[model samples]
Target: MKVVKIGGSVFKKENIINLAEFIVKNYEPYKTIIVVSALGRSPYPYSTDELINLFVEFKQNHSNGNNYLLDLSKSFVVSCGENIAAGLLSFAINYLNPEFKAIPLNAFQANIITTDNPIDSDIITIEIDNILRLLENKFTPVICGFQGVSKSGKLTILKRGGTDITAAFITKLMKANEIHIIKDVDGLKSAPPNIIPHCITIEKCNIDELAEATMNGNPVVNPEAINILQETNAKIIIKSIFSEKFTLSSKEIVPTQLVSNISNKDNITKFVIYLPSQMKNKTLVLDKVLKEIFENSISLDFINLDVFNNLASFIVNNNQVEKIKQILDNNQLHYKTMGRLSKVSIIGYNMRGKPGIMYRINKALLNEKISIIQAQDSHISISLLVPLKYLATTIKALHQEFFEDY
Candidate 1:
């Protein structure tokens, strides 16, 4: 079975029907399931301000010992559900192309149970499996994405950009052959086309390469989706639905090549602060001072503490220089923002296992006037944190030095 997840941006009333017809025509010999996110034709109409207002009202009602906020949240969630169902059904019946069975996705049968909190929900694989089996008798199921009802019968919603997660869960449970993630773009590219005009499409990329690219801010697909694919060993092809040409090629797109081809505006330079173990309890002082510095409005990512050794590391934006110093000075923490910090990642299954992998990576960076501040070795990736300013230079230099012919 092939499980296909369509993106919200590519969602069109006509496109949905068009896609259904195409899938039935091409893969009708095999079983296929479709999952759709609430984007495009039936977009969630609630504005940010309205969502916030509803959230606040819910909170106030809870504090005042009333169920009013709970009721409001449920109503709003149902409205979203209705829009999703209506759009999908309308697309199936009215907009679909000639010669295919067009069936409306009954909202009640789709009964996705979520958590009480509309903002969060968990995937009950059992429920999902039952739903899939129910569809086995007849009909290609179209599920409402990003929203579900919990076992307790409360409506819950998935996080933003969570349709991938839903699709992944379905794929893993079904043990499907491949996942076709149809979006607006042609496939995963060597780099953002606007930045590297010469960039070409990637015909083949292993789990390792996808992970490294996604972690480094590649725009093709979400990293979490890649991680899930790794665990399930399920193949995923990210392709553009609008493209007319359909040709499959066998080319191993090198990881280092892709890494060197890209540029990201949000490249983060992390600062890992190692403090004495005894100072862990005294974090109140650091916390107070850090709060004052944070108020200056610098964006912070992944502020986490190591329980074992009382270490804290936070990722900060590449451009926030003044704010970094302000936080350091006010806290009076003995620290140094290591100047030589960049991320050099290696992604390949065959490139796995040699005692000298780290040695080779470190030696290459060292020759390029780069220093490895911290190194993390995962199953298929070796990420080295190096100097921020020299990141691009070091990655390109390393690509040419070690992986040019790979």
Candidate 2:
């Protein structure tokens, strides 16, 4: 069985029909299970600030339209999940050229249980077991992507791009042949194209490399879903939904050798605040300070408190240092010391298991007078911490070393 995940960005009505046609015309020989996401039905969900504003708007004007709008936001999430399944099913039989029979799968009665709060959820097993039985019967199952019904009988939405989790879960439960995720983009890129215009596409990526790339902030598949795929040994492929054709079975989809020089540099600003760790109502003071910082749109980088040593340290955006200093001075806050920091992460698949990569990188940074505060390596990337002032020099040196030719 081939399990396919269609992303929300490609979830338009016309696109859904085209995808169905492509699948039937190309890959129908293999039994396929499809997973769909909610991003298709609405604009991306609100961010932390936007959600707060949405709530505030509701409070200011308590009207039926506002209430309906809020409820619709919730409903759109559920609908996106359901319609992806329903839309695919409807298109597969009625619209596609060489149409195949599609069996619409609903979580309502099936044990597909989830949590009430859409933010965090836990699934029940009995429900999963029942769903697996249907797939085992040679029936094509269309499952919703983001929303789930919890054990407590509450509706819950998965994290952003969470359809990947649904796909991985189904693969483990049904033991499908492989999972294919089709999105608008052809495949994962070395970096976000917007930031790095010269970024190249990756032909093949390993699970560990994929996860590390995501953790360092490029959106591919969610890192959590990658873990599940690794655990179950499920073969996975990510491709474009807008493609003209699809392969008939897992064997037809091949993995190729592909690598590209990539660089992603985080723009950093930092501020440091140091204070005695102990004082009466210290916790309350810190809370108020953090609230003010956040309210001013100043994001924190890292914070450490040493009670025994009677010291506290806060690191934030470098550009916000002046403002933060003014706030502290106005409040008559005294501190022992403060400083700024910056970080740069290098991401690539071929970077692992090699000696001296870190050594060479560090030496280059030192040659440029960029002092390293801390450094760490992962399967796909190296994260280096340094003074904010030298962030440009650090990125330029590293890029020259690894990507100058490209």
lDDT scores for all predictions? 0.58, 0.60
The number of the candidate with the highest lDDT is 2
TM-score of each: 0.65, 0.67
Q: Estimate, for each residue in 384-406, the C-alpha lDDT of model 1 and write its tens digit.
A: 66666766665565555544554
Candidate of highest TM-score: 2
State how far residue 153 of model 1 sits from its true place (Å).
1.1
Query: After aligning candidate 1 to the native by TM-score, how far in Å is the CA of 366 from where it should be?
Result: 8.7
Error of 1 at 280 (Å): 11
Worst 10 residues of 2 by lDDT: 245-254
**Model 2 TM-score, 2 decimals:** 0.67
Model 1 misplacement above 4 A:
13-21, 40-82, 85-108, 126-134, 231-233, 244-269, 274-346, 354-379, 384-406
